[model samples]
Every structure is written in C-alpha cells, then in structure tokens.
Target chain A: MHDEAVAHEFQYASASHQADTAVAGMWLFLATEVVFFGALFLSWIFARHFNQAGFDAGAERSELEIGTINTVILITGSLVYSLGVVLIEKGKTRAFIMCAAAAWLLGLAFMILKFAIEWRHDLDRHMFPGADFGITGDLAGGAKLFWSFYFFGTFVHGVHLAVGLGLVAWVILRVWQGAFSAAYLAPVLVVGLYWTFVDIVWLILYPLIYLIGRAT
Target chain B: MMRLLRGAFSGSLGTLAALFARLSPGKKEGIGWRVSGLLLTWAVMLILVGIQYGVSRLHFAPGLRPVLLVLSVIMAALAAIVFMEIGKGPGINRLFAVASLLWLLILLGLGSMDPFTRVMYYVHPS
Candidate 1:
C-alpha cells in the first residue's frame, strides 16, 4: 500500500477516535429510526385494535414458515455484518466484501419473498386493504380495520426494507471500490448497525402480525 | 448454537466495555459499568415483558405498556452513554440523552391516551 500524503493531512488522534465518531453518528441516525419505526408500530397497533376479528382472519392466512425463515435470515445477516467489520480490520478484503455482498443478497431475497410470494397470498385472499378487502367473520361489512392495517403496515415496512437495501448497496459499492481498510472501517460498522436496527424492527413485527389470532 | 450467539453478543459488548475501561478514567468515573448495566437490564426486562405478553396468561397489557416504554427509555439512555464517547466525549452524550427522554415523553403521553390505547383497550375493552 502506498503512503498517501493528502489522506494523512487531517490526522485523527487515533483509530478509536474515528471509530467513536462514526459510532456516535450511527446512534444518532438510529434515534431517528426509532421514531420512524415507533410511529409505524403505533399505527399497526391502532389498526389492529380497530379490526380485531378481521386481523385475526388475515393472520390465519399468514405463512408462519415464511415468517420464521425470514426472521432467521435477517438475524444471520446481522451476524455477517458484525463479523465483517472485524474481518475488514484484519485487512481481509475478500472476506469483507463477501460478507457485505451476502448481507445484501440476503436482504434482497427477503424482499422478493415478501413481494412475490407472501404478498401474492394476501392478494389472492382478497386482503388488499382497499376496495376488495372483506369481512369474512360473522360481523357485517368488510373487515376494513384488518385489511387497512395489513396493507399500510406492510407497505411502510417495505419502504424501510428498501431504504436498508439502498444503504447496503452504498456500502457494498465502497467495498467494490476498495475504500475500506483497517484504519477506515467506519462505513461497515455504521451500515451494519443500521442493518441490525432494521432486523430488530422486524423482530417486533413478525410476532405482532402473525401471532395474533382472530377475536371472533 | 444459541450459546455461541449469547457469547458473541456478550463478548462484543464486554470487549467494548474493556476497551473503554482501559481508556484513561475521566469525569464519568464508571461509565463503562453504567452503560453495560443499563444495556443488560434493559435487554432482560424487554425479554421478560415480551414473555409476559406472548406466553403468560396475565393479560396485563395496559399497565405493562407504560413500564415497558419506560424501560426502553432507559435502554436509550444506556445507548447514549456509549455513543456520547462516555470516556472521552460529553457533548454527544447530553444530546442523545435529551433526545431519548423527549421521545419517551411523546410516545408514552400520546400512547397512553385512553382513547388512543387501541391495542390494549381492544384486547380487554373497558
């Protein structure tokens, strides 16, 4: 590795200082994320409450196996991310890039699974949340509460997943461009933190969405 | 397998603690311990609360919500302790702490509103 002059101009006191700054920045960003996820969760709760039986109807159709698998995948992605930072510090560039790519691919697979398969099931079941949504329970009128929440909550969460993939792509791009090194592994750690936060949100969502049975 | 995971999380957090511990002791005499304490407590509390709802027949939903929210605030405080550069920086610490507390207020206040207590109220309507 060549000793780059311009890069050494603004000298950091130590690697720890740089790491600390990045970590602090990550936490601050996560604070905003907390607000974001918090609002979505609140909305889900309100809608679910408003349409208990309808939600239960939808829940019956949820594929627990898919939910369980996705949960495991995201958790595994988190491990890859945390471990990747350490590998980068060791200067294992190949492994580091592989980990980032794996995380990205896993994330993409999750989205596809949700959109292509899980979402299809909901659509076929007429759980579209808008006009076609219905009340299968004894109570009259479409179980509007359930369908509305299911649609809105998943859509909002889908947006978060999209944002997460965007961040992962940005990180992977830097890896491909050979920007990370022992002294500058901040990007991996920060993005990894963001990834884990996304996983945590799903951790809460999975049980809430799939576990609650119908009230009828 | 689960043991390894437990080890991984604990080990990393401990390593971070050890690193901070080694740094020259500053105004926050025991910030490392405090942060670790807060994190551990918050984690355990969250799990227990989750168990209460998921498995237990308690059905203690409303009363439990506020307590869990308070614990999450504490969790955020612990996170601030670490992120604020506890052993070295204070500016970021105060900022995060204040922000977390503000969040606690807004979420709990609006969240606890009787009319808005949709989740629990619907579960066991009054």
Candidate 2:
C-alpha cells in the first residue's frame, strides 16, 4: 500500500528528472520526424539535381513573398512560445498565458496565410500538379515533379504546425487553470521544443521551395 | 594576416566568455532580456531571409545556394539551443538531444546515396 501510494505512474524521483525524461522523449520523437521529412528532402535533391532547368522553372512560379512572410511569422511564433515557457518557469502565470495566446494567434495567422491566401493563389495560377498543371514544354514533367514535392512537403509541414498549435492551445488553457508552476513546467518546455522543431523544419523548406530558381 | 586572425579569435572567445558569465548559475535572465532575445531572433531571421532573396536576384555562383542553406540551418540551431533550452537538462538528456541530430545527419547522408548514384537506362527503337 505504501509503495503504491508512493509510486504514482507519473511520478519521478524529482521534478528535474521528470523534465529530463520528457525532453529526451520529445527529442527522440523529433528525430523520427526528421527522418520522415528527410525522405522528401532527398527526393527534392535528386529531382532538382537531375532536372535543374525544370526545377528552376517550378521554383520560379512559387509565391516567394508570401512564403517568406509565413516563414518569418512561424519563427517569431516560436520565439513567443519560448518566451511563454520562460515566463511559466519564472512563475508568472498570467504573463505566460498572454504570451502563449499570442503565439497561438501567430500560428493561426500563418496557417490562414499559407492555406487561404497563398494556396488559393497557387491553385488560381494552376501550380497544383494535375492535368491542368501550369508548366509546358520539355521541362513540364520535371516541373511537375518539383510541384509534387513542394505540395507534399508543405502539406505535411502544415499538418505538423496545426498539431503544434493545438498543443499550444492546450498549454494556454492549462496555464489559465493554474496547472503549472515554477516547480513543474515540463509540459510547457516540451511543447516549446515541439514548436521550435516545426520552425526549424520550415527554415529548411523556405530556401528549397521559395529561394531556388529565383536567379532566373 | 596572422595577427588579424589571432585578434578575431580572441575577440570571439571574449564574447563567448561574457555570454556564459551572463548566463551562469543563479543569474537567470529576466523577462525583459527574454523579450529582447526573442525580438533579436526575429530580426536576424528577417535579415537572413532578405539576404537570401537579394542573393537570388544577383547572378551569384550556384555553390552559394548550399552555403546560404547552411547559414539558415545554423541560425535555426542557435534558436533551438538558446531559446528551446535543449541543452539545459541532465547529461543523459543532452546525449539524447545530440544523438537525435546525429541520427538525422546519418539518415540524410545514407539515404541520398542511392538516388544520387543510380543510373537510368533509356531505349529507343529504330
């Protein structure tokens, strides 16, 4: 009975130990995510290397300005989320909640910009891979391959961001309910790690999808 | 040139030492400092994106493309280490953190070899 009372399933020897285990778990998950996205990157590299001209053509058609804006927003959102983590660790519950809410808003803004505005523009321009794909000539096939990777990568990334945002909302709700304190902030820290990982993924994606082929 | 390099190296070392001192135990950063750091990261990201766009406009060498990508990755890594505090936990946690990144490098490095080297054959009938 004493052992059962003392050994709660969620209990650790110390708060620090719990935090460490959570961080390790999060990193291991992120590692898998890296390999998951790495496959798409490998496909992109080979496709671009073999068909530089076609890849360049497709890259030129991307919405560079909007993509850049979204990248900036995502990184800034991560920063805000990190700030919330810091505030929570410092025992500033109200401030942490506010910062978390701001971060969530920024994430929502990014999604709206990416899907509603930029993707709609892409569809209008026939950038989507289909019978009506917008490119032509000898480079058409290669360009289609580029668009395929582009849409696939960005769609996967968007889904991840949506999941991160949901997690952020969860953290914010918990903060409002006084579920976190200086002694126990592992949840906030782990969510921040996930948010920053998403941002890192976007950092890689930006140059590949938007910056390439702009020299033309 | 030797003297210049020495001076630059010492300068960087001094800056790093100062940063460590500021972040030493029992001297946690305040909210203001955290806010400033956040803004600084945002500004750095914006500037890097601008530079990338500008470089693309110029007829720069193709090799510069990979270099710019590396630069952005480094920037992102800095944000991860500093802001996300990936290195703040116990020693084993740090090992796990580093291992994850190493595994990613291995995955990408080994995974690309097949696609990069495979030969495709095309047949034409007369």
TM-score of chain A of 2: 0.93
- Summarize candidate 1's per-residue lDDT along B9-82 as a digit string, tens digits: 46645654554455324645443344344345434534533442344223344323323334333433333333
Clashing pairs in model 1, backbone N/Cα/C closer than 3 A: A56-A214, A135-A142, A135-A143
* CAPRI class assigned to model 2: acceptable
DockQ of each: 0.09, 0.29
Candidate 2 per-residue lDDT, tens place, A1-216, comes to 123322223567655666667877887788778778877888887888788888888988998877876776777678667766766666778878887887898899889989999889999999898999899899888889888988899999999999999999998887777675565677888888888889999989988888866676
The DockQ of predicted model 1 stands at 0.09
TM-score of chain B of 1: 0.37
| Clash list (residue pairs), candidate 2 | none
TM-score of each: 0.65, 0.84
The CAPRI quality class of candidate 1 comes to incorrect
Candidate 2 lDDT at A66 equals 77
**C-alpha RMSD in Å of predicted model 2 compared with the true structure:** 8.1
